[model samples]
Each structure stands twice: as structure tokens, then as C-alpha cells.
Target: MTVPAYLHIVQYCAFGIAIIANSLLLHLIRMRAGLSFGRYRVLMISFSIYAIVYANIEIFTLPVMYMQGAGMIFYVDSVLKNHQDIGLLIAVSYCGCLAFCISMLATHFIFRYIAVCRQHHIHIFNGYKVYLLLIPPFFLFLIWAGAMFVCYRPNEVKRDFYRKVIADLYEEDIDQVAFIAPLYYTHQTDGSVLYRISDLLGCLLSCGILGACFTTCSICAYKTYNKLHDSAIQMSKRTRTLSKQLFWTLGLQTLLPFITQYIPVGLVFLLPLFEIQVGKTMAVPVYLHIVQYCAFVIAIISNCLLLHLIRMRAGASFGRYRILMISFSIYAIVYANIEIFTLPVMYIQGSGMIFYVDSFLKYHQDAGLLIAIVYCGCLALCISMLSTHFIFRYIAVCRLAWKMEVYSTEFLT
Candidate 1:
């Protein structure tokens, strides 16, 4: 299957997981009601809202991905090419979703930090305060999303993107490509002489909001951690454990959006602002490298979290599963590290860094050769380890499933 197809399947799986997990969480929260921490319930509600928004965003994005992969660019391009207002609405909503995600994560961090650090001040976040906190991001995004419309005419920027895609496909000079069709659609010009000012505005808006939220959360987390370490502090053992869980969960939540979305979008904006000439071919590898790097880090974080959860729930007597899990974790880490490390290095080397090879390689020929050989060895080891790990895992899981199936069949008979 194609990469986009694989990604599409993964997205659907994620959506399924989100639906089930979030539904269970919400149901449990309702069942427990006053039993658990009030802040947790509120956070879960926020998470649910964010998940719905994210799913919607994915719904819009999947079609574009499918269209691209299916060689139906003309289908999307025609609408984007012909209808200025439709393109503007789509662009604005997409940007809004991106900002909304960050905003929600920021709120998650803030809520968790406040709940742990400032118990006395927790009442401030209750009742109407939650609504007060959550609603502003919607309005803020609406304003920020409108910048595209204000900064440029509807369909103008989108037309540029479509034209760029067509030019690359036709092997035409992308630099000289312009909209040659007659002025059939109405165009609203913002008349801003600033170069790609909409992007700068977007960067400032997204970064400003997220930065503020991050800073606030950091301060709260520090104070809370310090309090936890203090013997004088009167927090219950359960509270402390819950606090740690909250922090870990928030950390994962924060990292996913920041790594996957925030940084990539920031780069997208900055590249135009800085005039980084990334050609069509070069862009894919760079984009994939960024994605893989983020996934690598996230996988490590998740493995650690999973280990912690296992220890917490299963104690030290997990038996064979402990060894199995540990081996899987180790292999995953090794493979991800190798993949992430090699991809960018390979990209750099393959891209033909003449200056580096000429100047540095000339002076350090022996060292460079040694480094390359060591890297090759490590890459080979990673491949071998991953192959073994996958084979063992598949056999173990399949055997377990077979046993379960046999037992079920016997019971039915």
C-alpha cells in the first residue's frame, strides 16, 4: 500500500481508539461523578471536545490525501481554482482547527498544573471559569483564521499552491507559473505589501497563545513538584500518584500536538518568511524526516509511560510478559533511534553536501570513514534486531490467539 493509504488506515484506527477510549472515560467519569478528582473530569471533557475537533479536521484532510494519492488533484484543484470563497472557507477552517488544537492542549496543561500546585486556588477554575477559559480560544481562532481573507484575496494563495503542484507535475518552471485563466471569480484583495504577512500573523498568534500557556503550566508544574518533594506538604499518597499520572498524561498530550502540528506548521510559515527554497522533491524527505523524528521521540515517551503503568498495576511479578514487554520496548527504541538518526544523515549525504565532503572530509578522512563504518554496523544491527523482535512478537500473539480460539470452540461444542 502507498504511504498515504497506510496513513489513512492508521488515522481510522486512531479514530476508532479515540471513540472507544473517550466514550469509556466519559462514561466512567459520569459513573464516578463525585468520587474522582473534579479537575480530571473537566480535563476529560476538554479532551473529548478536542478529539471531536481533531476528528473533524482529519475528515477534511483525508479526502485531500486520497485525492492526491488517487491522482485526482484536478477534482480538488478545480474547486479551489474556480471558487474563491469556498477555498477561503476551507483554508480558514483548517487553520482554525490547527490553532484550536494547541489552545486545547495549553488548557489541559494549565488545568493539570493548577489542580496539583495550587489547591487553594482550584476553585477559581471551577463552575463558569472553565467555560471562561475554553470559549476565548474559539473567538481568538476566528479572528486569526480571518487573517488569510484579510491579508490576501480569496483563492489567490490557494491558487498559488495549486499552480505550484501543477508546475511540479508538468516539470515546468514553478517560479514563472501564474494564473492565466480569465477573472471569472471575485477576488478580495487585502493589499498588504508585506511578504506573506498572513503566515507571520498566524505564527505570532499560534505561538503567542501556546507560549503563554506553556509558560504558565511550567511554573505551576515546578511549584507543584517542589511541594510534592517537601515533607511539610500535606498531600495524600493517592493525590500524589494521581498528580504524577496527570503530569505524564499531559506531557504526552502536549508533546503529540507540539511535535506533530505546531513545529511543522511553524516551519511551514518560517520557510516562506525566510525564503528557504525547498523544491518539490526535497520537501517530501524533509517532511517525512520531521514526522519520523517526532514519532521516534513520542514512541520513547509512550514506552516509558507504558512501563510505568505496567509496574504500577502488575507490580514486579508480571512474569513472562515483563520480559516480552521489555524486549519489545528495547527493540522499538533501537529501531526508532536508528531510523530517525539515519534518515536525516542519509538525506544530508545523499543531497550531496559538496562543501562538507570537500572541506571536512578532506581533513578527517580516517575519522569520517570510521564513523561511516560504525553507522553502517549500527544500522545493520538495528535491522536484524527488529526482524527478530517482530517475528517473536507475531508468533507469541498468534499462539495466544490460537489457544483462546481452541478453548472457545471446545466450550461452544
Candidate 2:
């Protein structure tokens, strides 16, 4: 099967898991959920509904993501490939779905706080008021989706920036591709890259949304955790056990995202602002070295080919790009060699992890520091080269000459 077809299988499997897993959860909630869980049970079901909807969108859109600096480009490779407008909407809506998940989880935390700590205010979640609480998540979903739709709209400039990379990577014509990117900077008519205020603001808005929801969830989670253990609550053994179970359940849900979504996304967005790039790693246990090594081999071989091609075929047609590509290919090969030779090892102790790669050189380990520096230097070069190449494409296509004055006021602001 084709790559996307395989991805579709994964999406379909997730859909099945969503349905079955959520079905089981709902069944448990229906049968065993106590009076204290009445408000939470309803919200939990809605959460499952959101999950199913998210999976459904993935099945339809099947987006492939590529991150560049503080920006991300999404290429939709599903049935909607020909329908760029619809595909764009579907792709942007993925953000909404994730935001919905965040908001719903936050709502649950808010409700849990009410149920556990402030029973007198529990009436706020009863009757019609309960459904009213859905407004925040719904609003957040709209805000997230709306911001992306407005900021990341497809344009010649975007296609110009990513055209060759997309064409080279996906082997598809940029004209026919349906892609969206909320770029932090766009190459201006002149040669310099300018900060895309809208896109940056959109990203900041997303962070704000995330922060608000997380803060709400954290405060509520903390309060609920405390109240569940409080001695003055005067609860029966059964009631206390059920309340504790619910509190723990909600806490686990909150933590899963902090690991999966919040922290990683924060880093992904942050690293770009400072122009740092760490090519790729399993970031898991040592057993995953097989995957890392396989990637290293692939990187080495592909970069060798890329370097050779640039040398042989990157004539006048490649122009200035010829130089950048050659540098990148060399950097990739060196990076792979560094990984392979060092065979870096990492271990976890308590709550922290440390990783160090000793150079294969004998006795004199002074070279290890140089190896580490080279690795970081390669990443920085890779990131900057990518940005330069994209701007080159933009300037070449747009043919806009940037005056030196443009640099002082608006470039990379």
C-alpha cells in the first residue's frame, strides 16, 4: 500500500479505538458513576464525542505536517487534495478539534472543583446551566479555527516559499497541492524576510488559549486534589473512594496532554523563535536505537545522493540555491556520522534524564566536546539554510528587490 494509505489505516484504527474505548468508558460511567459524577459524566461523554469527531476529520483530511522554525506547514493528501478550499478548512479545523479537547478537559476540571470543593455551587452545573458550560469549549474551538483560517490562508508567497521543498519531498506539483502554513516570517518583495505579524499573532493567540485552559485546569485540579483528601468534608467511605477515583481519573487526563501536546508544542514553537533545530531522535528509551540508527542510515545515504546531485546537476539553474543545498547535504551526512560513531547513550534518574555521546577516539576525549559543538552547529546551519532557501525561493519567484532600508525596520522583527 501507499504511504498515505498506510497512514489512513492508522487513522481508521484510531477511529475504531475511539469508538470502542469511549463506548466502554461511557458504559462504565452509566453504570458505576455516582451522584458526585453526574456533572462530570456528561462532560466526559462529550469529550469522547469530540475525540471521535477529531478522528473522523483525520480520516478525511490525512494531513502531513512539516515544521519550519516557529511555523508549521500542513499538506493534505487525502481525498480532498483536489478540493483545496475544503481541504484547507478541514486542515484548519484540526486545530479546533485539539483546542476543543483542551477546553473540554479544562471544563471537566472546573466542574470537578465545583463538585468536590464547593458543593453549594454545584447547582451551576445542573439542568440547563450544564449545557451552557459547553460555550467555553465551543467558543475556544471557533477562536482557534477562526484564527488559523484567517492567518494561514494559502497564497502565492507561501507556495513560492515552500514550492520546491514540497515538490522535492512529496513529488507533487505545488500548484496542485493543498497546503497551509502559519509562518512566523515571509520573504518580502525585497530579499529580506519579514515577520508575519498576523501569523505570529495567531500563534501567540493559540498559546494564550492553551495557557488559559491549562491555568484553569491546573487550579481546579489542584483544588480538587486537595478537597478529595480533606478531613473536614465528612464523607462516607464509599463516597470518598468514588470521589478520589474521579479526581485521579481527571488528573491522569490532564497529565497525558501536558506530556503529549502542551510541552512538545511549546518547545516546537519556542525553538524556532531562537532558530534552533535538532534534526530527529526517538527521545525514548535505549531500545529505540534501532529506529534511530535506521534514520541515520537513511539520512546518510539520502544526503550523499543530494550532495552528488548538487555537484553534478546543480548548474546555473540551481543558482544561489546550489550552494545552500550543497551545504545542507554535507551537514546531514556529517550529522549522521556523528550519531553513528558516538552511539549516544541516555539514562533516566528519578525525574530527570541525561545524554552524552563519547567520541570513538582513543584515550584523549577532548574531541568529545568538539563533537558536541559540531552537532549543535550543524543543527543551527540546517535551520538557517532552510530559512535562507525558502526566502531565496520567495524572492526569486516574486522578483521583488528588497532595499537595504527594509532591513532596519521590518525584517525578522
Candidate 3:
């Protein structure tokens, strides 16, 4: 897939931001974290490092995922595109990170629960034993990646099925594209569908991992919350307050990924398991952007050159059309600056579509929205300008009656 120039801009921007942000987080965890953190501070720093790794791999790979029916086509649009073997690892690592994210969060909650409710087991996270806390997430990470690599083998039937969509959506031949697709439903000679056992089992494995992690987090959170509330358990005022604050903060943090990652991953599995056919509209709008930007660049250059030529001609040859072209050239430059910088990523789900902008305008909510609107409004004007430009050309070239006489109009004529 041809990556959007703006996507590279976005990913690199995000990469820089994630690096700085996570670096700061690591520093904060070490310096600012109080004595109460103890062994837990080690876990926190490890997770922050994990997050940095997560962001680095994701940004580097820049995988564009499109879900179709029960299957999904995952491919990279990055520097790694030519290196399928490496890209494959990066892609699998990206998937593993998803699992690790869940498992790590679960560990955090479980650790908290143990610290508050069962101090005896807290030894698992102390000193060198602290590294043991990382085992579950890392284990799940490998398992998830292994399952993805083993189960989602590229085959002829799957290739044939995906051929048209690949061509239409990505402008890439199915044969040429290296993508991982796991189609759950297999069609037979009689047109009856048989369950792809590999796909089903993969989903089971994924679901089991997800369920266990979520369940652990839930049970620990519940027990820890109740334990903290229990007046019977003796603790100092500062200790109690700090524990409660950290517990609630972890709970809130867990909620973010649970909502963002877990729920969507569940849907990816559950929707197909129930055989709900949600039609996929794979309109990336990247094609439009490509053509528009390419034309806009030419427009800027050619129009500027034309204006220079008209300047040498002293505006007598092209007249008001020269002024119009110059105005359009200026407009094109302004439009390019605004739209390319605040380029929107659009997503389609079911019958709805979403436009997301995570550019510099992200902090300014209303301004971001207004800028998006302006960008879109400019696009509409560009469309209108195309027709208007052609109409004026038709009048000048084909219609003699309405044609402007060269050097005939002295003033407003």
C-alpha cells in the first residue's frame, strides 16, 4: 500500500511524542515515586519501558488493518514494506504488544491486590522476584504472536476471496501483496460453510488469554477495593490515603485500555463467532488525497509560472483570467498548507464514519473541528473551481460571442 505522506508525518510526530512522554514517565517513576512504591516502582518503570517499546514498534511498522467480514487484512505501509520477513516480525510484535498491554495491566491490579489483601504473596514482586511479575505478560506476548503467525497462513482460496477488495481498496494485486488474513468461515464444494478449526482455535486462545487477564484484573480490583474499605485491616492515615489514591489511579488507567483495546479485540472475535455479517466499505480516501495533492502541487507551480509569463505579457494576453489563475495559485498554496498539516484519518464502522485529527490542533478541540471543517470546505470549493475553470475555458475557446477581446477592455469591460 502507498502510505500517505501525512501518515508518515503523523507516525513520526507520534513517535517523537511517545519517546519524550515515556522518557519523562520513566524519570518521574524513579525520582518522584515515594518510598511506598518499593518493589512496585520497579514494576511501574518496567511497564513504562514496555509502553515505549509498544509505541516504537507500532510507529515503525505502521500497519494499516482493515477488517472484512470474519477476516482481516493486515499489511504494512512503512519502510519495512520491502522486508516481508522483518515486517512480519514487527507485525506479530505489534499484536503481541496488544496482549502484553492487557496482561501488564492485569499484573498491576493483581500486584495491588496482593499488596493490600494478601501480603504473603507480595514476595513474588520483591527484589529479583520482581522480574517474575513480568513473566505472564511476556508469555502471553509470545503465545499471541505465535498463534497469529501459525494460524493466519496465506492461501489461494483466501487470496482469491480477497483479490478484488485488495485491488479496489489498496490498489495492489493480491498476488503481490504480503498480508496475514484469518478467515474463520471456510466454504465447501456444496456451498456449505465449514468452520476453519485453526481460525476458531486461534480465537479461543486469544479469548482465553483476554478472559483470564480481564478476570484477574477484575477479581483483584474487587478484592483490593473491599479490603481497603475494611476498617478491620490496620494501616496509617498517610499509607491508607496513598494506597487508595494509587489503586484508584490504576483502576482509571485500566479502564482506558479496557475500553480502547479489549472491547474492540473482543468484538473482532465475537462478531464473527456469532456470524454477524457487517459489510465492509474499504474507502481509505487516500486515493483522493493523493490525486488532489499531486494536482495542487502542479497547480501551484504551473499557475506561478503562468503568472510570471503573464507579467512579461503585461496581463494583455490573458487579462482577467491571469488574475483568476494567480488568485487560484495563492488559494492552492493556502489550501495545501491547511489540509496537509491537519490531515484527517477517517474510519468506517457499520453504517457510520468517523474523522479523526490528532495533529497540533488536538489540544484545541473547537479549533481542530473548525480547521477540519475549513479543510473540507476548501475541498468543496476546489471541486467547484474545477468546473468553473472549464466553463471559462469553454467560453474563451468555443463561444465567440462571450469571448474576451485581447486588449479591447480598457477599464471594467
Better structure of 1 and 2 per TM-score: 1
TM-score of 3: 0.66
After superposition, the stretches of candidate 2 with alpha carbons farther than 4 Å from their true spots are 1-9, 34-36, 187-193, 277-413
How would you encode candidate 3's per-residue C-alpha lDDT over 1-413 as one tens digit per residue?
44456656877887898799889999998789988887888778988898799888988688665556667667766677656677778887888898999999998997888889888777777679878888988999999999988887568877887788777756766665556767898567998987788988888898999999889999999999998999988978787888887897787677756655676567766776665534334444433444445545555555565566557655566656765576676777778777665657776779999886656785788989888888889988888887777887887888857765542355436
* Per-model TM-score versus the true fold: 0.66, 0.65, 0.66
Span of ten consecutive residues with least summed lDDT in model 3: 279-288
Q: Name the lDDT value of residue 77 in candidate 2.
A: 82
**Which parts of model 1 have CA positions greater than 4 angstroms off?**
1-34, 62-84, 152-165, 170-199, 282-284, 304-314, 341-413
**Taking the tens digit of each residue's C-alpha lDDT, what string does model 1 give over 294-375?**
8988888777767766666765444344554666667667666655444433323464743222213335768555545554
Q: Give the clashing residue pairs of candidate 2, or none.
A: 190-402
lDDT of each: 0.56, 0.72, 0.75
lDDT of 2 at 124: 79
Q: What are the per-residue Cα lDDT tens digits for candidate 2 across 1-413?
A: 12334446766787788778877887887788767567667788788777767878877787765555556667788899768888888888876877888888988888878887888898877777888879989999999999989988888877777676666556766678677777787555777878889888877888898899899998888888888788888878877888776776777676656665566566555656665543222342322344356667667756776686578767876555566677778878877887776666556779998656643542446677667666667778778888987886777667546523332235525
| RMSD to native, candidate 1 | 10.2
Error of 3 at 284 (Å): 8.3
- Model 1 scores a C-alpha lDDT of 0.56
Give candidate 1's error at residue 233 in angstroms: 1.0
lDDT of 3: 0.75
